[model samples]
Target chain A: MPKSEFSRRKFLGFAGTASGLVVIAGCNKDEVVSPGTLDGVDLGSGDIGILNYAYALEQLEAAFYTQVIMTQFSGISSPEATLLTDIRDHEVAHREFFKTALGDKAIQDLEVDFSSIDFSSRDSVLATAKAFEDLGVSAYNGAGRLIETADYLVLAGKIVSVEARHAALIRDLISPGSFADDTVINSDGLDGSRKPSEVLMIAQPYIKTVINGANLPTY
Target chain B: MNLSNIIDEIEKADGEAFDRVNSRRSVLRNFAGVTGKAALAALPVAFGSLFKKAYAGTRGVQDVFDVLNYALTLEYLEAEFYVQSLLAPGLLSGQLAMSIQTISKHETAHVNFLKAAITAAGGTPVDKPGFDFSGGKGSGDGPFKNAFSDLGLFLAVAQAFEDTGVRAYKGRAAELLGGEAVTTAALQIHSVEARHAAHIRYMRQQLGSGVGNLQPWITGNMSGIDSELVQPSYNGEENTMQASVEITGINGFEISAESASEAFDEPLTPEQVLAIVDGFIV
Candidate 1:
């Protein structure tokens, strides 16, 4: 399913070139431009912090899926292509939802480093999907309480369930009939969850912007 | 090159403009149990599925410590379930085996991490306990055989336990927010648990057990001809229902992800948990 001309490496080079061009063009702007505090880079002082955190992850997902679409993995079948595409659309919807929900408080567009990923291979892509899906689920679980508004929490629940779907699909892709096996489910047939601070640490390397999560209010 | 000049130049243009910016979002009250009474006294008073009794009368560090202990208790129960299920005859295959093994390891890791965090926080970890999923207190075979033959029962119990775990983490997240290291690890493990629940539900779908495995709180449909299994609020394939229950204290709080009424697993308070778990050992 992959196009021969558009390798993930090639895509990165293009994105980097585009960023470089932007930097050069912005030389005349006279903003303070401190080490931190970009416009819309939510410092996460309170409940918005958790929402910002989810927003950041969603940004990463949208970026990854955009790249996936740009260069489909080689040797992928039609059903896999269709499923992956659906997942991509869902992630995009989630990304936009968070951006809209957070409005001006949403974090800026994050720069992702997926150079370590070999997207040409199905195994590599699915493995990455598994990781992202798993991380997204944990992110929501960890940040759920920090959210003050019930509407926001419910929104998170909705988004996280979508992540859970991604996790199921990725698990099955890795091995059929393995969806919801004991590994994802404990013996009691339940799932696991993590907190936001922990989830951010795992997601940080892939994200470039500084997240001011330290000052966010907690219980 | 001049820092003060840079600060002044920007400050002059928008000193008052900063006031128009939104205030930092407020931290939420502990909607689950924010009555401000003794932590230990909040027991047995059920808030949906989590029994209020679990947290009564416990003091400052102890209250936080109990939160971890409660999480540990749930993990232990889940861990034990996997340990036994893995050993059960003729029950698993392919990706299922690997997934279960990995989950076992994850649970073990969670238990260890929580134990360490609790001790580091200067509170004693709650000892592990044997979880009895059997509804009937008198008959052992009824529960065991039912778990094996009626996969539906097994999934229902599984659903309750997983859903409880998901909410348990949500309830206790406030306590961990103070410690970054502990909070990060707890959240990671919590999400893993959510994935596990989804996976289990997917498996049930494959096996055609047709329990409302996907949405635990909202029941939609079961394969059998029983009204007990028919949840009204689920929006999945079986029912176009929506969740009607709501949680007080929190604005816009919907208790069930799905809008159906099926079998609901009651919440356990820390005190009720202690009482129920008095003699149990993991």
Candidate 2:
């Protein structure tokens, strides 16, 4: 607790380097490597690392949707409810799909912390949903190359497109004609593509699980 | 004429057939090898059904240069189409105008990016093909008669184009996998295409044509669109199967046919995509 001491662990925790922590621990590269959030879970190496990365996100999404349905936000319209339910089902299906596909390779279910999210507020929920969906698209796009098998690559595509659809729908609901706004799309006309380490970092706060993805394959 | 004879010939014949797999892939690979007069006498039917599936399969170890050039062609078509629309007088207004304007700029950027990518890869970029945009339904009497006047039809065509682009990128995704950086770039474009498709679908819904069940995601049940012109673009979209398993048939999980179909987007072959847009090119 001394003022002179730099809290590397605390800084990494706050920075959401949870998954990156695994890599530092596994690789003793002489240089000082910052660890991720304390007690972060391991995402397992290889395809399982990528799969766990996806499963972890799906779990967060499914939890969010379940909460949205449970505590109905005021002014929620029939169309909105119906649309959300469909999205909810789709997210659940996706979550279960990865869980089943990974099976023994799958990471344990993570504890999601949504205390900061105001479930009763429709705007808050939609904003969070939008972020999650957009991040999911980029995460998959970024992870596409890391996949060793053609079968898994195609499977990831199948899910990412739906996530993109959800992102577009949510963006329009928040503000019409804002689906592919400049925020996510770069000057190259390409959409956002975030690394697994980066995505997990952004998703750290929502997840309390310590995911060790240090052994994940890099292309 | 005989299936057994074809199988017998395949068993003994070899050379450039590629990796062998049972049933589907093997049938396609064998058909791939018999692509000339020398093999014609061995089989009569030519496995027409199997050929389509094989053609629709992955690029299977293609060079990066070929992938870039192929992608460049699609970008050129899209960028040009958007450029034409934005040039039309009073064609777009309000939110529709703004949305299409942003998309137009993005497509323009995509064209430039792909051209650069191809050039950097030491491949000659394909020449831009002149587009008719009217689907050749009539003479090039200005797009006013074709789609500009009516916002619904305009968005419908836009939806088709973006949807095709999404599938087009996906179909070739596997080939780019061998190159990490290029694969990331391709998927980035692919995701953007999906986002564009979703926005167009939303715009169509806003037009309030009472087009039931139109949404951002492809339900693959585009039978509601009722247009022969767009059918080729939407072909195979109705599939309720993924990873070779029927959507509803999965154990301990229940998904309505519609939800299952909506859950995943299928890839469209380049030929199928071209067939949809070729009529638009003069």
Q: Candidate 1 local accuracy as lDDT?
A: 0.50
What lDDT would candidate 2 get against the real structure?
A: 0.68
For all candidates listed, what's the TM-score of chain B alone?
0.55, 0.73
State the lDDT of candidate 2 residue by residue for A57-131, as single tens digits. Answer: 888888888888889788999878877877877777777777777778887887887755777777777777787
lDDT of 1 at B248: 18
Docking class of 2: acceptable
lDDT of 1 by residue, B113-208 (tens): 565444433345555644544533323433334553354555545554554465456445545444333343455555556556656655565566
Worst 10 residues of 1 chain B by lDDT: B20-29
- lDDT by residue (tens digit), candidate 2, B1-282: 222232232223221233212233223222221112243345433232322223234443224445666677678778888887877777888888899988898888877776555443324455665666776623665432467666666777788889888888778677665455567777877888888888888777667755678877877658235466687777787777766566653446666777777778888765666566666654
Assess candidate 1 and give its TM-score to the true structure.
0.55
Q: Score candidate 2 by TM-score against the native.
A: 0.80
Write out the backbone clash pairs for model 2: A17-A36, A40-A210, A40-A211, A41-A210, A41-A211, A41-A212, A42-A211, A42-A212, A43-A212
**How many steric clashes between backbone atoms does each model show?**
63, 9
Off by over 4 Å in 2: A1-40, B1-62, B137-145, B249-254
Model 1 docking grade: incorrect
